[model samples]
Target: MFGDVMGMMGKIKETQQKIEETKQRLDTVLIDEQSNDGLLKVTLTANRTIKNVSVDDSLLEDKEQLEDYLVLVLNKAIEKATAVSEAELSAVAKDGMPNIPGLDMFS
Candidate 1:
């Protein structure tokens, strides 16, 4: 019984390490989104940090359109980043969990 407890503790520590590594990897992941017309682009990391925004010089003259473009691109970038983050975390969760009797349904 003590051996089982010790084994579980070791697995928990290993899972914690993997979680930290996943977070670090998320910081390095870059997700980009561009407008359909290619006039605007936004880049973000899986950690949801905006990395860059680019807009066509032609759009600068039209303030209203530029605002729209910026908003649209930013939203797309954030959405994609969120999806990527979810997928990564799900993978980590699956990896970190150990199979146990009658508990597989929870995953």
Candidate 2:
């Protein structure tokens, strides 16, 4: 019985290690997504930090349209970044990771 317990404990440790490694790997992996129109765009890090933005010549032709384009692109960028992040993190949760509350920690 003691030997069996030790083996089980070892497996748990290994799993925890895998989760940590996976998180680290995810932190290193980066993905950039943008909308069809370049009027506005954002660059995000693997950890979801806005890195940069771009504007298009056509959108700037109209001040009002430029503002709308900026808002639209921001929303689209956020949506895309979140989707990609969630998909990647799903692997972490599926493997039995703990949830970080308030982060919308999803599976």
Candidate 3:
């Protein structure tokens, strides 16, 4: 019926709006992570863009150690950022994705 088609069209429009809102929400999300001893730190966006990094002055004296710690700290920050992105995206998907049989399994 025409009424049923109209209702489905409205739902699609609403879902599109929700998707845009979720993208905006993701843009504002920032995740900050630091090394165990606080010698290195990094700030990353939920979209995996590195925003900032801070390293203790002492670490700068040793190039080898600094490289090691840089890798460690960067990896930690990336992991945290990925987790945040996944959680936020999953929440948005659960809210806006169309309902279909067996679709929950993929989620």
Candidate 4:
């Protein structure tokens, strides 16, 4: 019984390490989004760090419109990045998890 517990503990530690590695990898995974009119564009990492933003001259003419565009495009980018981050992290965690009876958290 102690052996099993020790093995499980090792597996959990391995999983935690993998999770951290995956998070670092995700920082390189980029998600791009643009306004429907293509006037505003954004690029961000799966970690939700903004990398770049491009705004059209027309958008610059209207402060309110630019803000609206930024909101919409940034939200879309964040959503995509969040989805990718979650999927990658979940896969790593689920794959690393030891099969323990009565713990079907991943399922």
Top lDDT model: 4
lDDT per residue as tens, model 2, 1-107: 68776775676576677767766675665555555754466776556667777777776789998787767766766676667666766665555533334545443
Q: Write the per-residue lDDT of candidate 1 for residues 2-107, one digit (tens) a residue.
A: 8877887788688888888898899999998899999988888998998888889999999999998988888888888889888887777677766666767427
Work out candidate 4's RMSD over C-alphas: 0.6
Where is model 1 more than 4 Å wrong at Cα?
Answer: 100-106
Instruction: List per-prediction Cα lDDT, in the order shown.
Output: 0.85, 0.64, 0.80, 0.95
**lDDT computed for candidate 2:** 0.64
| Candidate 3 RMSD to the correct structure | 2.4
- After superposition, candidate 2 runs with Cα above 4 Å error: 1-37, 97-107
Query: Which sequence of candidate numbers ranks them by TM-score, best first?
Result: 4, 1, 3, 2
Rank candidates, lDDT, best first. Answer: 4, 1, 3, 2
The residue pairs found clashing in candidate 3 are none
Q: List the residue pairs that clash in candidate 2.
A: none
Query: Every model's Cα RMSD, please?
Result: 1.9, 6.2, 2.4, 0.6
lDDT of 3 by residue, 27-101 (tens): 678888888899888888877788989999999999999999889888887888788877876776577655655
- Please identify which of the two predictions, 3 or 4, would achieve the higher TM-score against the true structure: 4
Candidate 4: regions farther than 4 A off: none
Q: What global local distance difference test value does model 3 have?
A: 0.80
Q: Could you tell which candidate, 1 or 2, scores higher by TM-score?
A: 1
TM, every model? 0.84, 0.55, 0.77, 0.98
